[model samples]
Target: MIEDHPQRYALVNELHARPFPSLTVPCQAVYLAVKEPIEAANRDRERDLAHLRALLARHGAAHPAPGATHHSAEIGRHVLKWESHTEFVTYSAFSAGLCERPFDPRGSEVFPTDWLGVAPGKRIAAVLIRVEPLPADMSEVVTKLEDWFVPESLAASWVLDEAAIIAGDFQIDPAGLMRFTVFARPGTGARRVGRIVQRLCEIETYRAMSMLGLGRARDLTGRLNALDPQLSSVVAALPDDHRAAEATLHELLELSAELESLATRHSFRFGATGAYEAIVNQRIDVLRETRFMGRQTFGEFMRRRYDPAMRTVKSAEHRLEQMAERAERAGELLSTRVDVERSAQNQKLLESMDRRADLALRLQHTVEGLSVVAISYYAVSLATYALLPVAEALHWPKSALTAVLVPVTFGAVWLMVRRIRRAMH
Candidate 1:
């Protein structure tokens, strides 16, 4: 028997998890995503599960297992799908009936007000999706769409080879929820309808999530503007500011630290923004949309309105990276200059020491010459005194005797001193 890997089953099940909801026509799905504004990714998953249980308890529904990332349950007349993500949680309720009025808040009755009040996080995206069979006259959809949405921002498209017509204005309705209408053509499978509904919800959810970076980008722009002038001044003064070399270096280090700090604080968000933006684009692309009745498709809508904000985020990210690189390069150049100056100063110090050593050696040689002359004078005096008696006995002159001994004594003393010096060496 073969032993399975520990995570084999778990990994396999993960792929099949969160299956698409099987919904027939005339169905409504109320979708909502919630997230903690700060430190969401590190939030306690148990609390999210608890919140999900609270909602399920309201309808007397069964609870999900512990550590579940997603769950689906029958709550009253609707099926509620709950999914937990890295930074947020989503709740989707599907019912097989639509309200008398299209995109009406009454269709979202599955989530009671009291249940939503105690939610653990803030609502990031909320949407009301209404699915129905396409009517015979396409002009009716146009008329109803104009009345239901702000026409200037409306995007209507035929997706999946005209199997479905989806429309939305991508704006918040008076009831504070995004509205999406999916009209499935005849013979469209229930699963296909459900997939389209899911995609619509995902598009809006990811779109809302991705836009969170816009505020960060704008704030970063302001900070960078303030820092630019300071950085420029420091760099410009480097050439003439020899006295302030250390001070300038210090200032450059502080500036570099700040830029690195900015990068650290926002790197995760910027990276996550790019990922979410890509997801939004991919989701829309999978729909394979074509323009309907001259209205803009989702892609075109994003290019005009959404792309600018995304571009702003990208521009800020690029500018930050470029500035950081410049700071690093400037630091390197300054460090090299500092090193060169230090080396030159050290060379001058070594030269001064050499001059002092030469003077000391000359003074020592002069002292040695004086010592030899003094010793010879004493030797001659002592010898003359001892030879005075002999000179008297031999009838020799004291001056002549002393003169002869003077040269001899001096020569002997010089030889002795030289020998001692050589021995010491």
Candidate 2:
């Protein structure tokens, strides 16, 4: 018998996880995404689970198993789908019906104000999707679109080989939720309708998440504005021969530290933004949209409005990196200059030490000469004293004897001192 890997089944089953909801036409879905404003990725998973439990309890619904990342349950007349993501949680409720008022927050009772008030995180995105069967006449959609969405920013398209006509303005309604309408062609499968709804929700969710970087980018721009001038001032002074290297080095280091802090603090947000942006684009691409009624498509809408904001984020990220690099390069150059100056000082110190050593050597020789002369004087005096008795017996002068001993004593002392100095050396 062959044994299976521990994760083999789980890994395979993951592909089937979060399958599209089987939704019939004339159904509507209310989707909400919640995320912690700070440290969302590392937020306590238990809190998210408890929040989900709270919602489930409201309808006397069975709770999902512990540690579940996604779940689906029947809550009254609606099917509630809950999913946990890296930094957020989403709750989607699907019901089969039409509301009397389209795109009105009060139209749905799935999310009560009190229940939403108790939610663990802030609402990152909310969407109301109304799916209807395609009408016999196309003008009905156009008429409803103008009434439902802001015409200046509307994006209407026929997607998935014209199986559905999807329209949205990418604007938040007065009720704080985005509105989308899906007109499914006749004979469209329930699963296909569900997929369309899901894609619409994702497009909004990821787009909102991606725009978070714009705020961070704005902050970085201000900081860069201040730091850039300080850095330039310091770098500009580097060429001045009168400017001190140490002072410039200190200023450069401060600039580098601030830039590093900025990069460290915002790296995750910028990276996440890029990933979310790519997902948004990819989701739209899969829709395979074509223009409907000479109106703009999702892609065109993003290119004009959304793309500029994304480009700003990219520009801010790039500018930060370049500033960091520039600071690093300047620091390196200043460090090298400081090292060269230290080397020059060390060289001069060594030269001074060599000159002192030479003078000391000359003084030492002079002291040795004086020492020999002093020692010779004492020796010669002692020799004269001993020879005085002989001089008296031979009737010779003491002065002559002293003079002869002086020459011999001085010569012997000088030779002895030379030998001693050589041995010491």
Candidate 3:
């Protein structure tokens, strides 16, 4: 029957041409990638083949049919092509998981265990089962599956039933390709492949949950920014003695970097097949980086990382304003004290103080205006000083008195300053 189907030979040939990572299990590996309406050509298929090859390489596995005998089966109403070995299987999607099952199992006396073992080492059986729909709900499905394959009591020998295998599985890629994974225990015989499939399913479920968490985090970050317009101002206002605001900001930045790293590790790239693995990897990365603290500590870190950082910034600003007010009050108190101390030498002291205050205020105003005036004056003075020596060298009028020319020099300087300022405006 297999020899008569030339298309099966073509399929096997194609699978062998691609790179697939070889697993130690006597199981079949299945990877699914969505095909769009535009990609319904031979060229597109060739491209998809290349992409699948890359995905297998990333997972540290090789294509099973490379120079080896294999079997081919069309799955999901012929929407997916499956390449199978004695122990392993690989499924490639011709379309998204949208195919209808052509045949019903009512008349056929197929056992649940038989159906479970049909895919061999393929870790995506749970996903396929879910998509096909059982005659019962998930709970009933689990119950029926447990009846077929009993789980072991010992951790070392704990066998997976079909229901336990399917519970936590489902992954949707960015391009909307969903993959289910199953994990197998070491040396658990053929049934280990079922465990691998179950693990894949669970990983998918967690991936979806993590994505929800990420969305919530993003929303919270946006709300924090909206609630606090001037984080820097708030930070500046914090009490002079309190440095927690600055520390909080630094910690929040560090946390954001950590989250970004976690997301990168967890996120599946376009055209990648292993969404479940990516999510699991990302979750593990985050847990490892965060050091698996208590739930309260994790919550605190999140709050501090996002909202409290803004609060710290606001606190800093409030403190600054308070400091400014205190400084102004202190200056007034000092002035009153000085007035009380100088009663004996009142007239002399007051006159001296008054002159000094006037000079100080005038100096402040002069400094404020000095940049333009000083620059212009220095430029003109340099030119005039140079002219003084030149005039002497040329034996010009000695009565010119360069020092007396200060007023004229200042007038020219003022005009130049005005011109520059006007040009700037």
Best by lDDT: 2
- Candidates sorted by lDDT, descending order? 2, 1, 3
> Regarding lDDT, does 1 or 2 come out ahead?
2
Which TM-score value belongs to model 1? 0.91
RMSD of 3: 21.6
* Model 2 lDDT tens row, 1-425: 99999999999999998999999989899999999888665788898899889888989999999999999999889999999998899999999988877865865568888888988889999999999999989999899999988999999999999999999998887788899999999999999999999999999999999999999999999999999999899888887779999999998998999999999999999999999999999999999999899999999999999999999999999999999999998999899999999999999999999999999999999999999999999999899888899988999898888878988999999999999988998
Q: Give the per-residue lDDT of model 3 (tens digit) for 404-424.
A: 556677777677766876797
Which stretches in model 1 have alpha-carbon errors above 4 Å? 241-243, 371-425
**Each model's TM-score?**
0.91, 0.94, 0.21
Candidate with more favorable, higher lDDT: 2 or 3: 2
* lDDT, residue 27, candidate 2: 87
lDDT of each prediction vs. the true structure? 0.91, 0.93, 0.38
Q: Which tens-of-lDDT digit does each residue in 302-346 have in candidate 1?
A: 999999999999999999999889889889888988898889899
Q: Which stretches of candidate 3 lie over 4 Å from their true place?
A: 1-126, 129-188, 238-279, 282-425
Q: How many residue pairs clash in model 3? A: 42
Q: lDDT of candidate 2?
A: 0.93
Candidate 2: pairs in clash: none
